[model samples]
Target: TVIEQYEFCRVHRKEEIIISYKIEKGYPLHIDFTILPNWIKSLKDELLKIIKGQQYSEYHVDAPGYYGTKGLAIILKTLTEMFVQSKILTTNLCIPQLLSQYLAQVLVPKTAIRLIAEDFNNIFLDMAKKIIID
Candidate 1:
């Protein structure tokens, strides 16, 4: 009844990790993920194949939209966003080989993560703007 134990794919796990980052100053990449248990791992591979093969999964992103595939979708979305941002920012920012060091010593450690701890000021500002505009 192991499958029965999982109320939802991945989310059914007793633990999940939340990663934080500085979105504006720079969404520095810091992967804080744990390996899935063997039981979940087994099911994930087949499910992942099916999910990735979908042509327009977003078209079906509605209620009850592949609940079993939510975890895979979320992981793909985050990585796509991060890497695409990285590509644009690296070229525009003109950061040299010291990218990792710069992200670590300068951005992440600066102000003791004050900006990050603030839940990103820009996001709040955007929400406020949307509310006012609407």
Candidate 2:
């Protein structure tokens, strides 16, 4: 229902993306990154390997209220950090820690959000390089 509606609104570009879910009594919450780009998906796979067991599920018990929020904020924040570290984006342009944390409840959901964010940052960096060189 919510997913279908979100898809519909997304397809039409009529509304900002919003995810809603209920925490099942025994089931662990999961974030679906299917709508994100392929690079994000691949990065997620890689991060999952590197991070070992520090996945989204580990944060569930600690931050049950954040389950409904989109992982976009975390993704963006990670990308900003990566860019700053690599000098692709200036440190001055980086998002403030307070604001970034406020936007995304968790900073290190390394399995999904962090990986996806890094992928997006890489894609943006590549595009920026191409544009600057061309």
Candidate 3:
């Protein structure tokens, strides 16, 4: 019998992000991903809509002093996640640092990040379908 395994990992730093993947035999492999809450996905969609300038009437109001740029939603969301996950000694909320890091890493080149996210979704869907079929 033949057994194969695959492993993936990512390292983050101020300079650059590094990703590694390897395949081996005999040894077991495990993958772990932080499951983002559904609220985050909804927020991302809302931010995307605003950035695309498809705001509805409810979102038309302006604050006391601001351009009402759609980009603010993303910025707020990032900060919220950071503050919640960080859980500093002084703060009560437990910010998720890993998610913050992942988002920061992807947002460097926005267009490229979007394309890569789309590709990852498609590939994962294909893999899911294969799993169902077999």
Best by lDDT: 2
Candidate 3: tens digits of C-alpha lDDT, residues 1-134: 12222222222331132112112211113321132223234345533443333642121111201101233344335435533344421122113324344233322123222222333453453342232222
| Tens-digit lDDT string for candidate 1 (6-101) | 666466343232222123333334422232123233333333333334321211122211112443344333333443344522422324425343
TM-scores for every candidate against the unseen true structure: 0.21, 0.22, 0.18
lDDT tens string, model 2, 1-134? 99999898777663222222223322124555454334344464444343233442323211222322354544554544543345544323324434344223332343343342343454443342232222
In candidate 2, the residue pairs with backbone N, CA or C atoms under 3 Å apart (3 or more residues apart, or in different chains) clash, namely none
Best candidate, TM-score: 2
Estimate the Cα RMSD of every predicted model relative to the unseen true structure. Answer: 18.6, 15.7, 17.2
The local lDDT score (0 to 100) that residue 15 gets in candidate 3 is: 16
Model 2 lDDT, residue 8, Cα: 84
Global lDDT of each candidate: 0.31, 0.38, 0.30
Name the runs in model 1 displaced over 4 angstroms: 1-85, 91-97, 115-134
> Which sections of candidate 3 miss by over 4 Å?
1-68, 82-116, 119-134
For candidate 3, list the clashing residue pairs, or say none: 84-94, 84-95, 85-94, 85-95, 85-96, 86-95
Better model by lDDT: candidate 2 vs candidate 3:
2
- Comparison by TM-score, 1 against 2, better one: 2
